[model samples]
Target chain A: MLISSIYKIPIVILLLSGSLFFLGLYPDISTIIGGVALFLIGMEYMEGGFKAFSGSFLEKILEKFTNTTPKAISTGFFTTALVQSSSLVSIIIISFLSAELISLTSAVGVIFGSNIGTTTTAWLVSLFGLKIKISIYAMPMIIVGIFIPMFLKESSWKGIASILIGLGIIFLGIGYMKEGFEILKEGIDLAQYAMSGYAGIFTYVLVGIIATIVIQSSSATMAIIITALATGQIEYTNALALAIGANLGTTVTAVLAALKSNENGKRLAVAHFIFNMTTGIIAIVFIYQLAELVDYIAMIIGIGIKNYTLKLALFHTIFNVIGVIVVSPFIGTLVAFLNKLFVSKKQSKGKSKYLDDSALGLPSTALSAVIMETKHLYENAFGIIARGLNLKKKNILSSMDLDDVVADLYTSDTIDIDDFYNYWIKGIYGEIIDFSTKAQINMAPEYAEELYKLKLANRDIVEAIKGTKHLQKNLLKYTSGRNRYIKEQYDDIRKSLAKLLRNIHTISTSNEEDVIILLLSKSKIHAERDDIIANGTLDRLIRKGLINNQMATSLMNDSDYAYRISQNLIAMAEVLFIDIDSDLKKLHVDMGISDEEAKSIVQKKDHS
Target chain B: MSIKKFIESVKASLNLNKFEQKGKKKAIKRLLQKLESRKEILAKIHKKKLKKKDLKELREEQEIVDLQIKKGKKLLDELDG
Candidate 1:
C-alpha cells in the first residue's frame, strides 16, 4: 500500500521537469514540444481512422491469411505498413491471440514482421521529408483532407480522409522538429558530447528508449533521430544506437495491451518483448559490421556514400532482415520456451473444451466446435448413466454381452446424478447453448438449422441422463430384492440400455452409414417394444400376482423411465452421428417413420 | 366418516390417488391415435400406384412399418399373457 501510494505521484510533474530541462538546453523547445504533440495526435488519428475504415474486414483478413508462419509474417508486415503503426498491429495481434484466432507461434511471427514494417517510416522521412520542403505539401494535403471528409457521406470515406490528414500532419510535425533541431545545432552541438566507445552507444540507446517511452511511438523517435542526423546535430553511431533503443522500447505497447487480455495474449506480448530485445542485442553487438554492410548495399544500389539519412534507412532494413533470418530458425524452440515461461492456468473440468470466442465468426468451424463440445458432454453423461445403471462403462462399450454383465452384478451401487449433472454436464451444456446461439447470428439458414439440431441433440443427451437418474432409485431397490420377476425386469432394463450404448459406440467408430442406419432403426423398434405401457407388460405382471400393487407401480414407472432414456439416446445419436450425410438424410425423410407413428403402431398392435 | 377420512375420500375422488394410472392412460391413448393415422397412410400408399421414383420410397416405408407391427405384436403377447 505504501509503495502504491508513493508511485501514485502524478506523471505530469515528471513531464514538467523534463520539459524544463529541455527548455534550459535549447531555445526552440516550444517548437519541439508542439511537434511532438502534433506527431502523437497524428498517430492517434491514423490508428482510429484505419480501424474505422477496415472495421472487421481486417480481422477477417488476419484470420484468413495467418495459416502459416511465413504468411503470418508477411500479413503482419503489410498490415502495419498500411496502418503506419506497429503498436496498433501489436494490439490487434494480442486481441487475435486472446480470441484463439491465431497460435502463439503465428503471433510471434507477426510481431517479427511488424518490427521490419515500422522501418517504413524511417525510409519515408529520409527519402521525402529531409530532401524536400514537405511542409508545403503538408498544407495542401491537410486542406484537401478536411474538405474531402466534409463532401463524403460514407463513414469509411471520412476515415480515409482522416488518414490523409493524419499523414500530412505527421509530415508537418517532422518539418517542425527538423527546423527546431537546425536552430539548436547553431546554439549547441550535441555531437561534441558524444563519446567514442560502448559507453556512447549505451548512453544514446538509453536516450532513444526514454524518448520513445515519452512519445509512445518508436516511429516518431526514429523521425527525430533521422532529422537530427540530417542536420549534423547527432553522430551516425549514436543514431544507430538510438534506433536499437527505439526497437526495444516499442514492446511497451504490446505489454500494456496484454494487461487486460487472457494468458495467450500475455504470452504473445512476452514473445514480442523477447523477439525485439533479442534483435536489439544482436544489432548492437554487430553494429559496426552492420553499418559497413549497409554502406556496401547502398553503394551497390547506386546511392551516394554521403547520404547518411538514406544509409540509416538501409541499416534499419538490413538489421531487421538479419533479425528475421536469425530468429526464424529458432521459432520452434522459442515457442517451446514461451510455453514454459507463461504456463496457462489449468482449466476446470467443467469448462467447454472446444467452444471459444474466435470460432464464433466462422460458421462451419463454430458448428464443428459445438459438435466436439457436445460429444464431450455426451461422454460425461455416458459415465453418469453407466454408473446409475450399476454397469461398468468399459464392459458396456466392449464386445462383452450386456445381459451377462448386468446378470453378474447382483447389487447396484447408488449414484448421485445431481452431483454428476452439476459437476460435468451443466456448465458445458450451458456454454454450448450460449455459443451456438451467438454463432447462429449472421449465418446461412442451413448452417443455422444445423446448429439448432446440435442444440436439440445436446438437450436430448442431458434429458437421457435425467431419465437414467429417475430410473436409478427403483432399479437399485428391485434388482437387490428377493422378488425374482422384478429383479429380472430391472436387469432387462439395464441390459437393453447397455446394448444401446454399445451399438452407438460401434456406429461412432464404424464408417458404413447404411449399416448404422439399419442398426439404429432396429434399435428404435426394440426400444419401443421394450416399453411396458405400449406392450402391456405391466398389466400382465399385475394380473399374474407376481408383484404387489406398490411394487408393480414402481416397476411400471421405472420401466417408462428406462424406455424414455433409450428413446432420447437414440434420437440424440441420430442427430449427432447420422445427420451429417445429406443423401442419407433425404432417404430417411422419404422412408423413415415418425416417433409418434412408431409409438402408435406399437400401441395398436398391443390392442389388437 | 371423520374429518380426516372425509378429506382422504375427497382427494381420492379428485383422482389424486390414481395419478400414475391416469398419466399412463393418457399416454396410451395418444400412442393409439398416432398408430391409427400411420395405418391409414400405409393403406393409402398401397391403394395408389406410386411412380417408379417413389416405388422404392414406398417399399422402404412399408418395411419400417412392418418392423414396427411385428415388434408391437410381440409386445402385445407379453402384455396380454
Candidate 2:
C-alpha cells in the first residue's frame, strides 16, 4: 500500500522520462534525477511495508523460544534468513529488544542469524535474477496483485494483498530502472572512467560502503555494482572487494542503535561488527582463492562465468555462508570478547547510571526501562523486609547484634537508598496520587480509584518502616530470660515475625496478590497472636519473680510495635483496594488504639 | 548445530507446545491443590508429638513434596512459554 501510494510520484517521472525516449527528445539531467528518486522511494516503501507486517510475529516467536544463549543465536540466524534482509530484521529486533520485550542473549542470536539470512538475497540475485526469466512472471504477478484487493473481506487478507501488490510493483520498478539506465547507457563515458581511470578496488569498496550507508540497501549497492559489472565498467576482483565492504558498512544501523542503549545493545552491535570484520578480513587474506572457489562452483553447476554481476553476487553469498559455518563454534567466545571490549567499564560493573536519555524521545523504550527499574526497586524493598522480619526468628544475643545486621545490610549495595526513598518511591506515588486526584476531579473514576489504592499501599509501607530504628535498637534488650515468660514472649514474637517476613518475601513474585492481602487483612488475628504472647509474658512476670514495673512496660512497648506493624500492613492492603481513607491513624483507630496511646509509646524509653 | 535444529529446539521449549492447553491448565490446577494439601499435612505433623523415627520420616516426606512442586512448576513454566 505504501509503495502504491509512493508510486504516484515515480509513475509521473517515468512517463515524462519515457516520453522523451520515444519522441527522440534527449531527457535533461533533471529527468534522470527524478527517475533515481522514484527508484529509491519504491524500494524503501516496499522494504518498510514488509518490515512492519512481519516484525510483530517475528518478535513473538523469538521471545517465546530463545531461552538459552545458543538457542538465541540459532533463532536469530534462522529468522533473519526467513525475513531476507538482515538490516530490516536487525532494526525490528533491536527495537523489540531495547523495549525489553525480548532478552539480551536472544538478541545476540538474532544478530548472528540476520547476518547469515541476509546472504540469501545475494544468492537469489546471482541464481535467479541472472539465470532465470523473471520478466514473464513479473507482469502476471502485478496483474493478480492489483486485482486481489477488490475481493478480499478480511483486514489481514487485504494486508496480504497489499504486500503482493507491493512485490509486483517492486519488480516493475526494477524493470523501469533498468530500462531507464539502458536508455542513457550508450551516452555515458563516466562508466569507463569509473572502471579504470577514475577508481580502483579501494575506491569501489569505499563507494560500496557509502552507497549502502546512504541508500540503506546493500542489495541496491549490489545491484549498482552488478550493473557496472554487466556493462563491463568494473573488474570482478574489485567488485568482490566492494561486496565485502558493503557487508561491513550495512552494520552501521546496529552500531548507531547501540549508542542510544545500555551494555546489552552495545554488545549485540559489537558482535555484528566482529562477525562482519572477521569475514571481511578472512576474505581479503585469501581473496583470489575465495574468488576461485566461486568460479569453480559456477563452472561445476554449469551456470557459466560470463555474467560478472552474477559471479560477484555468488562470491558474496558463498563467503558469508562459509564464514558463518566456520565461526559458529567460536561465536560465543567472539561475542564475549567483543562485549568486553566495547561495553564500558561502568556497564560491565553493572552500574549503568546512563539512562540513555535518548530513550525519553521514545516512550515505549523509556517505559521499558522504567518498568525494569521499578521491579528492581521492589525486589530490594522485599529483601529488607525479609531481613527485618527474620530478626525475630534468629536467636541474636543482643539488640545491638540485630541492629548491626540490619544497619549493615542497608549500608551495602551501590544503590543510593536516599534517592530510592525520596525519588523513585515518592516520585511514583506522587504521580499516581496526582493523576488519581485529577482524574477523579474530571470524573474518570476507575483508573483514579486504582491509583489511589496503590498510593495508600505504598504510603503504608513507608509508615511501617518509620519506627524501625527505635525497634532495632531496643527489642533485643527485652531478652533477659531471667523471667522465663518474658523470654518466651520474645521467642514466640520472633518466630511469628520470621514467618511474616518469609510470606512477604514470596508475595511479590506470587501469581496472586489475593493470598498476600488475605494474610495482611488478618491484622486482628495478628493482634490476638500478640496478646497471647503478652499475656503469657505477664503470667511469667507474676510467676518468675525478677519482674519490675519498668520491665513490664518494656514488654508492653514490644507488643505495641507488633500491633502497630500489623495495623500499618492492614492499611496497606486496604490501600491496595483503593480505600482512600485508610491512613495510619485510621488503621490504628480500627485496631482500638487511640492517637494518644500510640504517641505515648513512641516517647517511651528503652528499659535495656 | 544447523539453524533448523536450533529453531526446532526453541519451538520445543514453549510449554504450550508440549501439551494440549486444556490438559496443561488442568495439570497446573491439580498440582496447586496437591501442594496445598501436602503443606497442611506437614504443618499438622510438625505440631504433633511423635517418635523420633516418625519425625525423620515426616522430614523426608517434606523434602519429596518440595521436589515434586519444583519439578512440576519448571515444566509448567516451559509450557506457558
Candidate 3:
C-alpha cells in the first residue's frame, strides 16, 4: 500500500522535486543532470518511434527469428543495436516471453545479446562523436527532424522523423554532457577523490550503478563515463569498474517492468539480473588481466594507449562477449535453474493464463489467446456447474450413464457459488474482456468480428455460471429432501443438465468436425426440448398434488436456471470449439434452423 | 415375396418399420450412426486434414444428425407404452 501510494505521485512532480534537489546540491553539475534527462527522453522517443513504425512488423520478425539460440542471440543483438536501447529490447522480450511467443531459453539468449549490443553506444561515442564537433551536426538534424515530422501526415513518415529527431537529441545531449564534464574538471579534480586499487574499482562500480539507476538508461551512463574519461575527469580503472556497474544497472529496468507481468515475465527478469550480476562480478575479479588484454588489443589495432575512451569501449565489448560465450552453452541449464528458483504458482482464481500485453498488438495471436483463455473459463464454470448440480466432474465426463450418476445422489455439501464465481470466473472474465478491448484497435474487420464472438462466448460462460449459482439454492433444498416427487423432478433437471455438459465435453474433445457439429446441434435441441415449463411437468406435478405450491414455485425458477445453463454452455461450445471459417459460418447461419423453429417443432410434436 | 412384405423386410433390416416396441431399434441405429459420424469428424479435426469450410459443414451436419438421434430417442421413450 505504501509503495502504491508512492507511485501515485505524478511522475512529473517526482522529476521536478528530484531536479530541484540536484540543482541545489550541485549547481555546477545541473547541466550534466539536464543532459542525462534529455538523453533518457531521447531514448524513449527512439523506442516509441521504432514501436510506432515497425511494432507489429518487428514482433513478427522476433517470432520468426527466435527459433534457435544462435538465431535468438543475433536477433537480440541486431534489434538492440538498431534501437540503441537494450532496455527496450529487454521489455519487448519480456512481453514476448509473457505471451509465450518465445521460450525462456531463447529469452535468456536475447538478454545475453542485448548486453553485447549495448556496447555499440560506447563504440559510437568514442570512435565518432568525440573525434568531431558532433553538436554542429546535431543542430541541423534536430531542425530537419522536427520539420519533417510536422509536415508529414502519414504515421510511418512521422515515425521516421521521430527517429531522426531522437538521434539528434541524443547527440545534442552528449555534447552538453561533454561540455559540463569539461567545466567540472576546472572546478574540481574528481581524479583526486578516486581511490587507488581494488577499492577504487569497487567504489567507481557502485557510483556507475547508482548513476545508471537514477537515469534509467545504461547507454546514457556509458556516455557520461566515456566523456568523463576522455577529459581525464576520472581514472581509467575506475571508468572500467563504472562500465561494469552500468551493465548491472540496466537489469533494474527489466525487474521493475516485470513486476506486474505473469510468471514467465518474472522468470525472465530474474535470469537477466543473474546474468548481468555474474558478468559484472567476473569483470571486477579479472579487472587487471582484462585491462592488460585491452591494452594488447588496442596496440594491435593501432589505437594509442592514451586513447582510454576507445579502450574503455573495447573493454566493455570484450567482457560482455566473454559473458555471452561462457553463458551461452548453459542456457538450457540456466533456464532450468531459473524455473526452479521461480517456480510458477498454480493458477489461482482470477489470473489470466494466456492474455499478455504483447499479444494485444498481433491480431491472430490475440484471437487464439483469448480463445484459449475462454476455454479455461469454461472449464472453471464446468466445475461449478457439476458441483451445483450435485454431480462429480469425473462422473459427468466419464462414459458412465449421467442418469445413474445423478440418480442415487443426494446433496453432499453445499458449495458457495458466489465464492467460486469470485475466485475463478470474475477476474479472468474481466481480464479477457479488457484484453479483447485493447486488442480490437487497428484489427481487420474479420479479426475484430472474431474477437467480438470470443468476448460474447466469455459472457455466455459467465452467465452459465451465474445461472448455476441461482439454481444451487433450491437444488440443495429439494434434492436432499425426502419428498419423492420433488426430488425426482429436481433430479431430472440435474440429469438433463449433466447430460448437456457431458455432450459438450465430448464435442470439445472430439476432433471430428462432423461429430462435433452433430453433438452441438443435439445438445441445443435437447436444451430446447427438455424445457420443463414448455413440457408442463411442473404444472402436471402441481395439478396431481405430487408437489406443493411452494415446491412447484422453486422448481419452476430452478428449471429456468437449468435451461439457461444448458443453453449458454451449448452456445459457448459453438463459439469456442467449432473451428469453422467465416464463409461457412455465414452459410450455416443462412441455412440452419433457428431456435424459434426448433421450439415450434417441439410444440408441433405436442399438438400432434 | 410380395412387394409389401419385401418392403417390410427391408424396413425391418434398417430398423425403421416397427412402432409397437416404440422406435427403440430405429433410435439405436440413428444413435450408432451419429456416434460413428462424430468419430470420423473428430478424427479429421485431430489430423488437421479437413479444410475450414468443410469442417464447418460437417459440424453442422453432425449437429443435425445429433438432434435427429436425440428426438428419435425421446419419441421412442414417449411411445414406450
Q: What DockQ would candidate 1 receive versus the native complex?
A: 0.02
For model 3, the stretches where C-alpha displacement exceeds 4 angstroms are A1-28, A139-158, A251-262, A300-304, A348-351, A356-427, A434-608, B1-81
- On DockQ, the stronger of 1 and 3 is 3
TM-score of each: 0.55, 0.53, 0.58
**For candidate 3, what is the lDDT?**
0.75
lDDT for each residue of candidate 3 in A1-608, tens digit (9 for 90 to 100): 00111222343244445556778777548666666666666666676577556555566667789889998888878887777766556656666766667888888888788778889999999987788978788778778778664444345556677787888888887887788788888889888887879988888888888876666667878999998898889989999999998888777755775687567767877877878888898999999999999999999999899999999999999999888887788899889998897787686756888778755534556676788789888888888888887888888888896668896453488988899889888999999999999988976566788789888889899888889889889888888899999988888888889888888888778765445656666676667777888888878988899988899889889888888888788778878887533222432342234587567656755676
CAPRI rating of model 3: incorrect
| Residue-level lDDT tens digits of model 2 in A1-608 | 00122223544455456656654455433343343344445455445445435534565667676777567767766776665545555554555555466665566666766676676666655555434444455667656656544443333334455556555554544444444455566676345645442246567667777866654556656665665565555567778878987886666645754675556556767777777778877877777798889889889877677767667777887887677766767766776686567654432212222233333322223332333333443343444443343342222322333334333332221333344456434544444344334334422233334445455565666655543323443345554337656666655555554444444444434443223333443333444445544336566665666567776776677666766666665555443332222222122122222334333322331121
Ranking by lDDT: 3, 1, 2
Off by over 4 Å in 1: A1-27, A137-162, A252-261, A352-608, B1-81
Number of the predicted model whose TM-score against the real structure is largest: 3
Categorize the docking of model 2.
incorrect
DockQ-based ranking, best first? 3, 2, 1
The two-chain DockQ for each candidate, comma-separated, is 0.02, 0.04, 0.07
Ranking by TM-score: 3, 1, 2
In model 3, residue pairs whose N, Cα or C atoms come closer than 3 Å (at least 3 residues apart or on different chains), thus clashing, are A511-B42, A512-B41, A512-B42, A513-B41, A515-B38, A517-B59, A517-B63, A518-B62, A518-B63
Stronger candidate by TM-score (2 vs 3): 3
Candidate closest to the true structure, highest DockQ: 3
Worst 10 residues of 2 chain A by lDDT: A580-589
